[model samples]
Target chain A: MSVEVEVNENDLAEMVEQVWESYLDPEGINPLIPTYDENQPSEVHSSVSISGSWTGHIVYACSIEAARRAAAAFLAMEPDEVSQEDLSDVLGELANIVGGNVKAMLPPGAFLSLPQVVLAPESTARFPNTERISGVYGIWDGEPVSISMWHSRADNNQEDGA
Target chain B: MTLSQPEFAFVSTLVRKEASIVLAPGKEYLVEARLIPVARAVGAANVNEFLAELQRRPNPAHQRKIIDALTTNETSWFRDREPFAALTDVILPELIKSRATTRKVRFWSGASSSGQEAYSLAITLQEALPSGWNYEIVGTDISTEMVKRAETAEYSQVEVNRGLPASQLVQYFERAGAHWRVTSQLRKNVSFKLMNLTAPLPAMQPFDVIFMRNVLIYFDVATKRTVLQNVAKLLRPDGWLFLGAAETTIGIDDNYERVAAGRTSAYRVRTGVPAGASRRG
Candidate 1:
């Protein structure tokens, strides 16, 4: 059911901060809360959706350069040698794993969907009933990267026992 | 600090060229996690030192350790018990009848980590078949360490707990302090060997059933295809292929058609081809 854990803005920020610190370099810049940019490349965002006790999604949205950099960091490879498909896979898997781990903290018996890479941030806008948790993380290279978590309100209602 | 472009490229190239393994981007941590222990075991101070040694002169033993470390040994006895039960009741009965024509039944446990699966099959066959029923159980893994462990037939308490009924454990294993050892009779019916699924098929007789469960997720598309083809080559016509619950051959290989047996789904190699044709009919 739609069981809200009373997660405050501070807690959300803390979760994002911890995830970025542990998953990426610990010395990277603190993550900023959700803010959207229209000028960024429409083809740069990748996200993974996980459905378990709570149906939710995690997105790793950034520029082409940032995606390449994130892929390099995740795969422990050079950015120059990282192929587009490799970057897509790396980002998608990162989102999936992060989403899965976060979902584990939320509730048990949650089923994580396979990760998918997409072209536009707004593509996610197709799901209007999703509760969005968004943040912007700064990397050691001083580049701002955006990450978001979405939970479908409809799915939550469906999960309700009553 | 993040690895430079050259360093990442170098490592990726080394993984592909030397190990003949493809490292998916997200799996870099897996490489690091698996190799760090191996590097330490080989007395290398760090991954850099290990890589340096690998580059200068690749020791076969060290290479083997790396492969062994990379293999994910997540396995359980009678994992997804329905299949094994089905094998005991339905599949084995039919196979025994069919194989009676030849007076032999051969089963293979591909990706058989530490021998529980093969031994499980052997014990089931031993219990189900009449005395002196001729059957051979073969367990194979890419990791020599795993093969060795499987041959030893000794399992930790935790390992024995997973999917192994107390009744079966008591019957098949002798208490070895903290560990359980498969009885000599069970161990005698099974053989453990080292095999890489990506490589050519080993020279062996065709198997009536193959259990290659839960290990395919690590491979990319090409590797999966190659492995499936090789596995198909070793499977007898109408042989069964039991995969993990979450795994399938739908997009990966078409040589085997999915067959539903009660609650479980396994694959059967397509028949009706020329006897010598390599591809499934």
Candidate 2:
């Protein structure tokens, strides 16, 4: 059965902090005081699904520049040398790491999907049957980044029964 | 660059059929990006042009290159730091004691990319077991290039920095110009092979421990079931199976039971017909 515990923005903020410190930039990661502006551009997006006892989606949205920088750090290459594939790969992995940690916090037995990276400019992701549970905004080297969780409505209905 | 719907569907079908890896719809960027180099290698101007060529005549060599490029994974020594802890603290000690009569132990690093995992097992077992113990470490992956790299036992500076600590790096590796090669001692007990997890495996001895970390996430339910069935055959009755921390055997296979060791856990094949041991969909 899915764990009915609520995941708030602060929880997501903490998770993002740990991931960035461990994998990306330690010194540059900080929680943004306020959530990102709706108008802020999100040039690249990455996501992963967690299925099993609990089914949900974890999404990471960042500007192209931010993604390129993250990819450079992950691949240990210069920013100029980072290809679109490198960007997608690194961002996808970042989402995978965060998604895996988020799953760990939930009910056990939930399985993570391989990350999916979307490269369209100024794009956002939404699931029809899921509602936003938490959304955290942060800045990495002055670029806006966001992480959000969505829980399937079916899981919520089952929670009501429990 | 984003992949068009037709292109996304095309690569998705090909990747799934070829590797049993599900590339969902939104991963269009990955499909295009992964294929771009393959496109360039074959002298195509762009991904569209390359797709056109692939459509005209699906070259096996180009297909292999595409699969290899798309199959890349990020790994490091002691990744997640839990399974290794479970290994040294719980699994290894138990195996060594139980196998004292044979003085022999074997490990299978399923989906071992670039050999870090197989070598990690060798590193831990080197100190955990007695000097004269017979230990075998076999690493396998579907990518032929990764198999070759694993055979070489070489890693770049970036890879070494990922999860390897400074002390172990210096202790277990020697400089090989631009890269570091696993010490002869570390590579001595390890072997690499090319094996696709989705397909049936060849004849092999039962293993005492299997590191099936991080790969099953890409497989569908039936593939996961098939892989687990095969693993049941390969693993001895008392053997340990370590999956990625995010993965579990709950719904996919019912023959295994979770065994906790501190913060991490190991799964053991249930013996004696467990109460709810019947496999379920």
Candidate 3:
């Protein structure tokens, strides 16, 4: 079984863009544009873990305004009507959908853990013994957002080279 | 105005205490957007203003509306493919054989958002059961708002697009304005009501099958065990219980033993008999 494999950043950004265009914004005039920086600040974060073939985490983080916009788009309500719980669920679901798609690209037999949402001013979503493998940041509807992967640190000691 | 850190933490504690849905730290952005409405309803300008008012007084009604908005989910017909397949090929057949003598069977669809799962079960039953046999499906959820939506039995195209197939679309749903309304025949076999899974359950008729898929994941371990224990009482000894693919009874509860059928898994309640005595039987 392979432990560490190359996680292409463009591939993740493209998938996130596709999800945004298809589900979140049908009229995606300002499409997601990739950023060179990976450490994007976020007020809301939703993440899911992928196990089995690859042990890693998929994280989606965005600003509060951006989070509300996503929730408003998801629930088809005015941004004002979207609630705190709705924000968590929308972000969590976004992570789940994007994470599920990412899992399919991993080795056969990979499974996704149920998504968990976090609302901290400072949020860090690192799975046990895992470090950043590939990260992609982008701008969505004028708000900063990113989707990144973290592979197990054990992979370095045991399996080496990506 | 954007929600501040402390206010976010405050709302998190409130919802977790009330609903059992974990809004982990750093998830403050979630309810911040939704609280705009809540603030307005309570005569405040924003969530911050509402927080100030909440300190002075308690408004349970607006609090519930806030939770409902946050937790309500958009569901679709056959939301997950494998569960439905298990129902069509394995669970239903087993129940039909065991309950044939009674000519009646019942089902409970827990967290049945907007009646999709409940009606989906009804459709499966109508298709598989011998004609003229009696059957019913009862759906329950925590949100009364969602319960009302389920009662209406209508869905939008976006909702239908999620998992509903074209053939099932034509057969079971009739055109209603821009949305699709479940045909009257299917509606009769299903009903919806507000029931919280975290609370102790009311005594009810035992069911031949109970679908609590994807719902158990929302609660904590203790709530999961309580809900499953209640399920044990509601399900007939021979009845089937279906859970989300990711969820299991392994450590939470031991009353159910996994049974694999076709491409999916369903569980049956273990007989109270001791391990050694069961081997003799």
For candidate 2, lDDT tens digit of each residue in B195-235?
A: 98767888799899899986666666777788887787888
DockQ of 3: 0.02
Error of 2 at B227 (Å): 0.6
Q: Candidate 1 versus the native: TM-score?
A: 0.51
Over B189-214, each residue of candidate 3 has an lDDT whose tens digit, in order, gives: 88888897767888789888898886
- For all candidates in order, the CA lDDT equals 0.69, 0.77, 0.76
Please give the lDDT score at residue B273 for candidate 3: 31
The alpha-carbon deviation from the true structure for residue A141 of candidate 2, after best TM-score superposition, in angstroms, is 22
**At residue B47, what lDDT does model 3 achieve?**
80
TM-score of 3: 0.54
lDDT of 3 by residue, A7-112 (tens): 4775576667667756776544446677767777877788898777677788888889888998998999999999999999999999998888777567666778
lDDT of 1 by residue, A43-154 (tens): 4666666664667677766666767776777778888988989878877876775565455456446666677787455355755778765444444354546666677877
Model 2 residue B261 lDDT score: 66
Off by over 4 Å in 1: A1-162, B1-35, B38-73, B274-281
